[model samples]
Target chain A: MDTEPALFSILRQGQVLVASVHTALDDSQLLRLQRDLVGRVGTDRARGIIIDVAALDVLDSFGSKTLRDIAEIARLRGALTVIVGIQPDVAQAMVELGIGTGAVATALDLEEGMAHLAAALGPAWTP
Target chain B: MPGLTYDAGVGAAVVDSGADGPPEPSAAELHLLVTRVVRARVGNHPAAEDLVQETVARVLAASDRIDGGIEAYAVTTARNVIATMWRDEARFQRYQPRMVDLDEPDAPDMGVLAGEDQVAVRRALESLSVQERSLLLAHEVDGTSLATLAAREGTTAGALGAQLRRLRARMRAEYLIVASHREPPTERCRPVLVAVALRDQRRWREAGVDDHLAGCDFCADVAGPLLESSQQDSGRVAIDVAKDHDVVEARVAVRRLAADLGFDRSDVTLVATVVSEIARNIVKFAERGRMTFEPARSRPGIRIVARDRGPGIEDVELAMRDGYTTYGGLGLGLPGARRIMDEFDIESVPGRGTTITMTRYRKDTR
Candidate 1:
C-alpha cells in the first residue's frame, strides 16, 4: 500500500487552477486526477489549468497519455492545460520514445507553467 | 468437547514456513515429508514443491479440524494434493497412462471425502448432482470399481470414467473456493492463484489478472507474499516487472547501477530509459516479466536482460521500423532501446514470449 498522502494538490489561483503533482502516480490515480481536474475546471470556471510534474522522476507512455488526456479534456471544458517540469532526462527519453507533447503545452517549471496559464487566461485576469 | 485438543498438522505449517521465509524451503524434515507422500505417489513430478506449498496453504486454511495426529494428517493432506495434481494433468493435458489403474491394488480413494475441511468438503459435495454424489460415494467409499459401476448404470466404463474425473475436478475446484473462506470476484481468481502458487507471472496476466489481483483482497492475501520472492545477487540486480510502478522503480534502480558502473550522466539516462522502455513493454504486453542487470560476463561493460512470456512479435523486422505502433505503445520502445544501447538483440517466439538483451560498455578513456 502506498502512503495515503494526496497524489496531487489542486490550487485555485484567480481564474487558473494549478495542480502540483507531489509524486509519480499509477494509471488509475492518474485517471482520477484527470477527472477531478476536468470536473473542477467547469465547477470553478477556471480559464487555464497548470499541471506541475517537477517531482515526477519518470514519464512513461501512460504518464504522457494522462497528461495529454488531462489537457485535452480541460480544453473541452474551456480551459487550457500546461504540463510543467518534465526533467531533462525524462524529456530526452520521451523524445527518443517519439512521445511528443500532443497539443498540450509544456514549460520548464511551475513559474513558467503559471505564465503559460496567465497568457491563456489573458488581459482581465489578475493573479 | 469442552477441553483443548492438539492438531499438529496446522502447527507444522506455521513452523515450516520459517523466519518470514528466507527464499528457501526450511529443512529436509518437511521436504522429506512432501517427497515421501507426494514424490513417492507421483514419481518426481516437476510440480512437487507446488503440491507441498498447496498442502501448507490448505492446512492454514483448514486450521480447525482435529484430524489424524501430526504426521498422519499431513500425509493424508499431501496425498490429496498430489491426487488433485495427478488428475488435473490427466484430464486437461495429453493423457499419459501412469501405472495407477492397472498396477495399484484398490487405491485409497485419495481425498474424495477424506483429509479435507469437512464442512467445506460437504458444501462442495452439496453442489454436485445426486447421481454424481452417489457415484462418488459408491466408487470411493465402497471400493466399487468403475467397471462394476458402469455395468450397474448400463453405460460404458470409459464414459463413466470421464464423468467421474470431471465430477472430482469440479469437487476439488469447489472445495478450494469453500476452503479459501470467500468467493472470488472473478473466475480468473483460480488460475491467478495457481500462477501465484507456481510463481508463474505470464499465466498471471493472461486473463485481466493484474486488475483482478489488485482488487481482490482475499486472493491477494493468499498469494501476495508467495509471488513476491526474487533472487538477489551481489553481482547484479533482478527486478520483477508487473506494473507501471515497477517500471519506474526499475528505471531509478538501473540509473544508479549504471552510474556506479562509471557510465556518464547521459549514458545513465540511456540505460535508465532502456530499462524504462523494456520494463514498460512487459507491463503493457506481457502483463508481468523480469528485468535483470548483471556485470558483463566477458566484457568491460554491463549486461541488461528483459524477458517476458507474452504474445511475442510476429515480424521482428517490421516491429524494428520507426513509428510502428502496436499494443497501444508509442512504438519507439524496441527501436529506441536498440538505438541507444551498444548491443541490442531481440529473440521472440510468436506465442511464447520475448527476450531482449542489451549491453552498454563504459567508453575506454586513454
Candidate 2:
C-alpha cells in the first residue's frame, strides 16, 4: 500500500523492453508489474526484457520471487529476461538466498543487461 | 507502643452514647463499622476479637486523653491496630533479638547500610559447595535441628557441627575476596576475563574454565546486564517489520549498519540480505515483528536479533533443515541465514513467539 503503482518506468527499444525500477514496490504493485510485463512481452512481440534494479536497495524474497516468476512467464512467450544493475551486496545476498537468482539471467548494469539480451537473441540479433 | 494510655472506663463509655461528639454515623453504626474494619485485616486470626476490643478501647481513651473527636480518632486507632498486628506477626516469625551494629555493639538498631554487604553475602553463599550450602542454611537460616540432620545423614552431632563451622570459615574468606574487588587469585581467571572481553559468552568454558568461577566477581559480571552494552561502537539499530516496503527499509538500514561495523562489500550484502529475508518472513508469515542489529561490541562485526509474537513453528529443528519452507518451492531463508552467520540461534515457543539471534564477524581487509 505504501508503494506507488508503476514507480519504475518501462520503455521500448526495438525488440527489447527495458524496465528500470527506480523505487520500492509493495506486494500488489509488484504482482501488477509482473502481470503487465509478461503481457507486453507477448502482445508487443518483444524479443527480450531488460530489468535494471540499480536504484533498488533491496531485492527481498518476494521481490526475487516476482523476478523469477516474470522471467518464467516471459520465457513461455518467446522473450528472454535479463535482470541488471544488482549491487555488489545485493548479488551476495542473492547468492545466500541459495537459489542463485533462480535461473533468471543477470548482468552488472543496463549496458550488460542489453548485451546479454542481444547475445541470448543469438548471432543474427542486433542492438 | 503509642504514648496514649487507655482508661478502662472508656470501654464502658463507648456502649450506646449517640447523644454527643459528631453524630454522623450514630454509635451503633460506628461500632459496626469499626468491627468490620478490624475483621477485614486480621481475617480469622485467633487474636481478632481482642484486637477489635483494644482498638475500641484506644479510640475512646484517646478522645479524653488526646485532642481529636472519637469519630476521626477511631479511624487512626483502627489503622494502627492492623499495621501493628502485621508487624508483630512478622517479628514473631523471625523470633530474633534486636539487631546490633558491629561497631557500636550496645545499639539495638543496625541502621541503614549499603548493598556491598548484601552482594558480598550473596557471593560468599554462592562459593559454598552444594552440600555445605544446604546444610548451613538448614541449621542457621531454616532452623532445622542440627542433631536431627546428623541423625538423618547417619552422622554424629559433633561431626556435623564441626563441618558447619568450616563452612562458615570458607564463606567468610569468600566474602572478604568479594568485598575487596581484587583480581581472583586463581590462574584460570585470566582466560575467562579474556573470553568475556571478546564479547562472546559461548567461549566461556572453552577459554580454559573447567571449574571455579563460582561467586567470582567476573562470573557475576558476566551474568549481569553486560551482554546488552557489548556493541558500543556503532550502537544498535531496531526496525519494525510489518509490510513488504518495511523489508526494503530494513535491508537498506542493515546494509548501512554492516558497512559501519566494518563489514566487507560482500559481507555487507550478506547481512543486508539476511535482514531482508527475515524481515520479509515477518511480514509474510508473522504479520508483524521487530529486527535489531548492532556492532559486536567493539569487535569487528555485528549482531542481529529478530523477534516475533506469532504462530511459532511447531518443530524448530525441522525448520532449520534444508527444504523446509512454509511457502512451496525454493525457500532457503533460514537455512541460508544459518550458513552465512558465524553464530546463529533460534528459540521458538509454539503458539507464542520466536526469537532469532545471530552474529557475523568481519574479515580484515585493506
Candidate 3:
C-alpha cells in the first residue's frame, strides 16, 4: 500500500472556517472529510470553507472534480468554498485535462484564499 | 501714423486660415474614431476605455501644435498614444502575473468506504484456500493468460480455466454474503486494493487479463475500481535533463512502467523508440524540455506529454509528415510518435509553446 500522508486541519472563527489540506487529497479522502465537516459544523453554520493545498504537487482530473463537488456541497450547506495553493504546473495540467475550476474560488496562495473566503462570508463575519 | 501701425500689426497676425473651420465632428464620428483607436491600441474592448481617455487627453494637450484639420490631428494623436499605451500595458501585465504561485487545490479525498468494508473484502478472499487465492491472484491481478498460467503451473489450459471458474464462484458467493450483512462494498473499495496488488506484481499487460475480462463480468467488476485507483495514485513523473538527453533513463522508466502494466515487449520498444525521437528533438531544437509520464484515463494505457516553450514548428501539418525535417536524418519525430501510439495529439502555437501527447495501450493478457 502507498503510505503517503493524508492530513487535514480545520480552523474556525465564529461562523467562518478554513480547512488546510496538507496531502494528496484523493477522491476517497475528500468525500470523507467533506462528510465529517458537514456533520461537525452543522450544514448551516459552516459558512465558509477554504481548502489550503500549498503542499500538493499534483492535481489531476479526479482531484479537480472533487474540489468542484466540495464547492457544490458546501454551497448547499450554506457555506462558500475557496481553494488555495494551486501550483502553476498543476493549474496548467487542470487546463489541459479540460477540468473547470469555476465552481471553487481559486487563489494564488492561502492568505488571498482566506481573504476571498472572508469576503464571500460578508463584512459582518470577520476572520 | 498710429492707425497705420495698428493695421500693420493686425496684418502680421492674420495667418492663412484656409478652409472653413475644420468640419465639426459629429458624436457618431467621434465615437467611431475613438473605437478604432481603442481597438488598435488594446486588442479587446475591456481595456479600450482607458486607452480612449488617454488619447482624448493627449489630443486636448496638443491642440496648439495641430496645424491642419482638428479631426486629422485628433486621429493621428490617438493612434500614437494608443501604440504607446499598448506597449507599456503589455509589459506591465506581463510582470504582474508571475509564473509562480498559481497553485490549485490538492485532490480531495472523497470518503470511499469504511475500513471495515475493506476488511470484509480481505476476509472474503482469505476464506478461500491458499491455492484458490494464488489462482485468482495470478489470473485477475497478474493478468496471466489461462494457457500461460497452465503452462507455468504444469497443468492443461482446460484445467486452469475450470480453476478460474470455481474461484470466481467462490469469491462472488463470499462477496454477496458480506454485502448482505456488512456495509455494501463501494465500487472503489475492493478494486483499489486489487489494482494495488497488480501494480505491485508488475502485471499491467492487458492482453492475458483482457481475454479473461471479456467474458467475466464479475472479475471486471472486481478489477475496475482497483485500476482506477492505481491510475489516480500513479500521478505524473517529470524528468528534467539539463544539457544531456537522458534517453536511457527515460527508456528505463518507460520500460519499468510498461513491464508493470504487462505491455508486450514489441509495444514497449515502439514507445521507447518514439520517446527517443522526441527526446532528440528537445536536445537538438529546444535545448531543454521536460518529459512527463502519466496514466491515461482510457484503458490500461500510459500517456507521455512532451512540452517545450521553444521556437515552435513553422508548420505543424508538414512537421507531422514522415521524413519532413529542417535539420536532416530520417525525420520521423511526429509521425513515428503517432504510429506507435493508440492516440496522438499535438498542439503548437508558433513562437510560444508546443505540447505532444502520446498514448500506448497495454496488450490485454487473457
Best by lDDT: 1
The local distance difference test score of model 3 is 0.62
The docking quality of candidate 3, as DockQ, is 0.01
* Candidate 1 deviant stretches above 4 angstroms: A1-5, B1-233, B298-300, B363-366
Q: How well is candidate 2 docked (DockQ)?
A: 0.33
TM-score of 3: 0.31
The candidate that wins on DockQ is 2
Query: In model 3, what lDDT does residue B189 have?
Result: 35
Better of 1 and 2 by lDDT: 1
Candidate 3 lDDT over B26-96, as tens digits, reads 33354467668677656685768776766655654554566546567767777877778668878988987
CAPRI-style quality class for the chain A–B interface of candidate 1:
incorrect
DockQ for all models, in order? 0.21, 0.33, 0.01
Task: Write one digit per residue (lDDT tens) for candidate 2, span B89-166.
Answer: 889778654554446453444333346788889988997888889999999998989889999889999999877866
- Which scores greater on TM-score, model 1 or model 2? 1
Residue B96 of model 2, lDDT score? 56
Q: Model 3, clash count? A: 40
Residue pairs in clash, model 1: none
